[model samples]
Target: MKVSPDGQPTADVIARVKDIPLYREAVARGHFPVLEKAEIARGFPDNWMTPALAAALDAGEAEFVLSTGTNHARMQLIRPPYFLLKSYYRLWSTHPDIKETWEAGCRRVSLTTVLATEHVARVNAKKRGEEPRPDPRPADRRLDARTFYLNTRLDPALWERADVERMLAEMAEARQAHPQGWYHLDCSGYHLAHLLQKINKWGLWDAFSPPASIIHAYEFTPVNVRRYLQQHFACPIIDLFGSTELGYLFYSDRRGRYHPYLEDMSVELAPVTEGSGLFHLIVTSVRNPHMPLVRYRSGDCARTLDGTPDPAKIKQFSGREKELLESPSGPVAQGDLDALVGSVSPHVFVHQLRVLSPAEAVLAYTTFDGRPLAPRQVAALGHGVRELTGRRCVLDHRDHIAIGKSGKYAWLARDGK
Candidate 1:
């Protein structure tokens, strides 16, 4: 458990790294460097893909697959997709209260939370009359929840008539795929919250059956939006924290507590500073035999146990490291802001805290149309920020939170890195 300056790999990580052809020489040198995404991309198929691995992917195996991209732009990884899906399923199957609805079956439906940026890029390229490369064989053929909603993007008028009709149609299709009332809702929380809010607004609650479980990934879950889902659905709402490169690593429980579920992987928290308790999650996952990420910097942050990086005691996975804000007290993470807002009222759907300077900060946020944060709630938020970061902050109420062109939201957007 002792950390080296370079974060030494354990016997397991070393053994796995040695198995990869690319890392064989580095392993022989008796000192392995961290596996970086940029380094991995220098020569993609040649860097990590062996003839056997490439052939397997070419042959179309469900276990070995490709991804579009995640919140982080444009980086693709080839790994087992369903491997991540089943991890959540198994976690749900083992949980006590959380498993009540989903225990009967693993039936599920997926609603994509992100726009297919890659597809849009290709469409734009075609408009300019440039020949875009064809999608790799078999990789493009695998179908899952994302297949249904890749082309659409969310916006202010996301649930409008035409949109509502389309959503209802998609829901009907998903329902037909799973007739049982109790099922898992694999979706983006933002999309689901908006859909549920619209359903309530249009009085369409009875039109569709409630899902037994709701699993939201792809983006940071806002407290207010989560509250919206909790209020509407009787099922347990869980957050699966992971990326395409690394499968499901941790998930949130009903109590908002994060529990570790590593699959042939080990995680270490390397402190961002001396004793910040916030550390970079350096993961060594050999689960992907082709690309065994050893001491890979995930660019994600978390508060660990007892000011130490105890894998089992990960308090929360804040957003990306570059997205974190510098404050007078210390660095403020997305989870830190989430706590400040969530405590006051979980209904505060979208919040963006901009650090104007060391002395001032502005929190722009919105809630459901009818419910507003009370004066006390506003005061509590300001008080919490002041206590947490020693900043003179105030809540700037917003009518609506705008989605980016990518149909994604930024919980933390700063002036500079």
Candidate 2:
């Protein structure tokens, strides 16, 4: 394994860790020395536990357990030391630009439905008189709602019609009370658009104050969607990249380009198959001492604008690795689909493309809570998919699409085994 000048393992760290007999023995016995080290490093109570991670942490029988999987398969991963989370916070909070954003009291809303937000929502719901609602959705799990936003298990129906109107009214009232109040809107790209649509339906856009900025994390944001949101709002729309295990890794600047936030993490771009500009991302993060993920396969796809992984010169974050479609004409990446669909309906989430044949495909997706795509938008999505794949694709709306056991949205499912 190649260690950086600072003695931290590069992506090659995985191999080095594997080669360590003591470490291997500990892991083989389902003992997480890394977790213990992390706990000690973070100075937490010896028994301190993050409720969201309790299930995985207590599973002493598994060498590694997945913290999140979403659309991709769940990863039973080595846990990094708990101190790694602190390292991430220090890196992000101390960054001059990012710190300015955070210290300015800019709302730091997380737009993802992963464990972090789920935990918060669960913690928050306990403060209410009601029991946390039962979740039938694939992503629903009992969360500590006191610390999170809305619970992931809460039905989309709860945010519908009257409920949405009330929320918008409250937002408007907040704006009125504090003119300089900076609102931070965060979530999946699809959910933010849905919120905007609800505001629009109520003719509340003009009445509500535009947030100081908007951050879209967890999934790829299509180019057209980026343009549309930026054009409509007078604030900056930022896209961030990271995972549950890694936290935030990259953020877009004012120029609408991604810049690396992790000085300890290095990235490499490899071709999806062979001799293709389409590349897969491989990462080596050194901050997580408890569970260092070296050259961890993130299952995301991208193509460097300049064909290299120079953090300072990154030009774009294309899309997910598995979401690409290979057609006779060329490959259609998820960003392309995002662009087409966003043009049709910005509120669509959990998009999946299934190939029935070389010339036929099916598109399935769900709308963001409190919003629905118009019939015209659905037709446009079908037409766009057909045009991109050179195949007639059918667009279908489902009441819900199952989230993977890993709690991620799978955007593409190939037909047959």
The top-ranked prediction according to TM-score is 1
In angstroms, give how far residue 49 of model 2 lies from its true place.
18
User: What lDDT does candidate 1 reach at residue 9?
Assistant: 74
Q: Model 2 scores what on Cα lDDT?
A: 0.56
Question: What lDDT does each candidate get?
Answer: 0.68, 0.56
Model 1 agreement with the true structure over 1-417: per-residue lDDT tens digits: 333455677776676556566677778888777666677666665667666677667766524344544455567566654555566566667766567646565445556543442443444455558754443122222244323332244573355755565556556655556546445667878878777667778877666667667778767787777777787777778888887677778888876788877767778787777656788888877776656787788888988656777778887777778777776567878888897788888768778877777777778888877466889888999888878777788888887778766577777655472
lDDT of 2 by residue, 1-417 (tens): 233543234434544355433345533553322222233224232222333235445664213435555645444444543333444345445544455544555434343454544544444455565455444121233222111133243333225666555445544443444436765555566455555666676676665566665667766665544665766677666677777666667787656777777655766655666655566666666555445555556666666667554445556666766667897656777766765776777566557787888889999876644355677776788888888889898877776666554334556677892
Decoy 2 TM-score against native: 0.66
Tell me the alpha-carbon RMSD of every candidate: 5.2, 8.4
Per-residue lDDT, model 2, residue 18, is: 56
Worst 10 residues of 2 by lDDT: 138-147
After superposing candidate 2, which stretches have Cα over 4 Å from the reference? 1-66, 76-98, 110-117, 123-148, 151-158, 169-179, 308-313, 329-331, 339-352, 362-410, 413-417
Off by over 4 Å in 1: 1-7, 19-22, 57-70, 80-107, 114-151, 176-179, 370-372, 415-417
